[model samples]
Target: MKIQILTHTYTLTIEVETQETILEIKRKVEYYLGVPISSQTLSVCDWELLDGLDLDDYPIVTEGTKIDLTINNHIPAIEIRRQIHITVKFSSRKHNIEVDKTETVGSLKEKIHIIDGTPIKQMTLWFLGVEMDEDFRKLSDYGVDEYSEIIVFLKTTSRMVAEPPSRKLRFVVQTSSALLDSTCIPLEMKDSSTVYELRELLLVRKLLPIDDYIFIHKQRIMRENCSLRWHGVENDDYLYIFKGTVSRG
Candidate 1:
């Protein structure tokens, strides 16, 4: 079958056998692309391909199938790297590190792990109040310059306790726009809270202008009357507040 592999900045097409495993296909692509298989994430039609799975198993894996490849980490293209100082804030304590601008956020997190013994998976990094969830993105993407500060928040698992009758869902609300500064706000509401109710709260609280702004999660605009539970919004989930239109008289 003919398959296409797409990366952040490149696209490659290759022919593969139906009997070949996904790992084998990845190796072939890696040979041509020079990107390590370990860093590559393959998805076909938004469904992730497992290394152990055979290509023929999925009915969608036919000729001319387009597979999306995402690199989990960034690889520097330049040989000579310049170091810059950066500060990471974890609760009350702040840790500083010297990093190269070309290095990936994952690499920075690894350095932080060495310093504080915190596992990279449990730590979340934020720049300018926006969560740096995409480890593949370089520090420069967030406009990190010399002496830039990144907020570090550690995720903790709750100890087992008596189950409550009903649990409220807590999610993060943040603003994003070229015209406004980024801001993160924590919100707690019942599982049955609808988007309309949240909008009303934002209107009353004056956190965001209701008529001018809209809520977005995972790039999808939230609709009124849809419950938070319907969107699968869980604890610490981020919702972006974006300006819907420019106010022009």
Candidate 2:
């Protein structure tokens, strides 16, 4: 089963087997978070998971369960400054960038700008097929694990130009594992269509059950009022569908 490891600053998902020991899980956590196994404490609902026990021994541990991680020791400032290298792929070239896990998307753009001379305003970053549109959000918030490849697309200078009235774009809509058994629904829509219109189209076609759904394009929660083109959705792009609304507050 897959589970989530939640720390104070970030969250990550990992696949685990029922027969795996807790200590083994800690090692995997160490690989991901750089937190030493000796200083890591994992818990579910405040119940500490002991090292020797297998996941089978814990009845509450199951699929999609969130395990809270606490660092028992203070890491040295030098260790805290350790940066993971990620690949930034542009249209013509790809470069490696050293970045802290806590670095924000906006800061990453600045780094790219310094190295490649691309204007920060002209850059749009994509990770795991999702757009990292929120400037202030940390890279971890977008599930940007170590060595993740970020695709950078440069925007044209025609920002003020109006979009065509009607242009067809073919894309895929992927549902969460909990929804539609993680089905990939192929869709073709006008570029001018808003996300709300996409939802209505799904409902009209009986492709999705009537529910409050949130659309995510390139990992960014899509605005219902905004058109697909405005969201930087390209042909053959994949959009994710989740079952809840985002609360800004």
Candidate 3:
């Protein structure tokens, strides 16, 4: 019963009961956009209505419904997403980020700002093939597997005169869970990884003492294998990591 609202400006997601009327939905929309229900105009299922219609009518709107509202000329659209993987590129570097597809593009921009170490105001996300006038679909909707290529371009113009002109680049994103794990896990094990894979796995989850040596099951692993599988550890395996100081016994 999930539906998306593609308006002639902004997109939003909302939940509703089966028995609710359009007026009830309008109240919710009013709360979201800070617009009065009396002033709000609603269109469901691509049909333009002069007056509001009950959600319980011929077209049953359910949870995850995308509601569109227009303030002026800008048209905004919303869609329910199962999973979204977007690749962002800027400043000669590329990053792939994944989120629950239900997340809004506006919110996703905030995350890109953190990962790219840039301010949110400076970033704008644009889908190449996706029209600004069309409803945006989640990554899962397009069968974009873990390796599917979705290019995202980033541009920023700083107020500083010394800064260079903004630019664009390409990045690929996928919907695979394993890809996500591999992508992120490498960062945690990159340092001296050849000798401490297993240790990092469990140790990263804990606060190790600065001056203490770390090991597993009495096995000191500083110069040993860092490969997780080398310690007979599978991707899903769990092991305990302990921190201890060298004692003159």
On TM-score, the candidate that comes out on top is 2
lDDT of 1 by residue, 95-171 (tens): 88767676577657766876778776687889998888776678888889889999988776652223223359888
lDDT of 2 by residue, 17-37 (tens): 799899988866664455778
lDDT of 2: 0.78
Model 1, global lDDT? 0.70
- Model 2, which residues run further than 4 Å from truth? 1-164
In order, the Cα lDDT scores of the candidates are 0.70, 0.78, 0.40
Where does model 3 exceed 4 Å of error? 49-53, 60-249
Query: What would the TM-scores of all predictions be?
Result: 0.32, 0.41, 0.27
Question: How many pairs collide in each candidate, listed in order?
Answer: 0, 3, 9
Off by over 4 Å in 1: 1-166, 178-180, 245-249
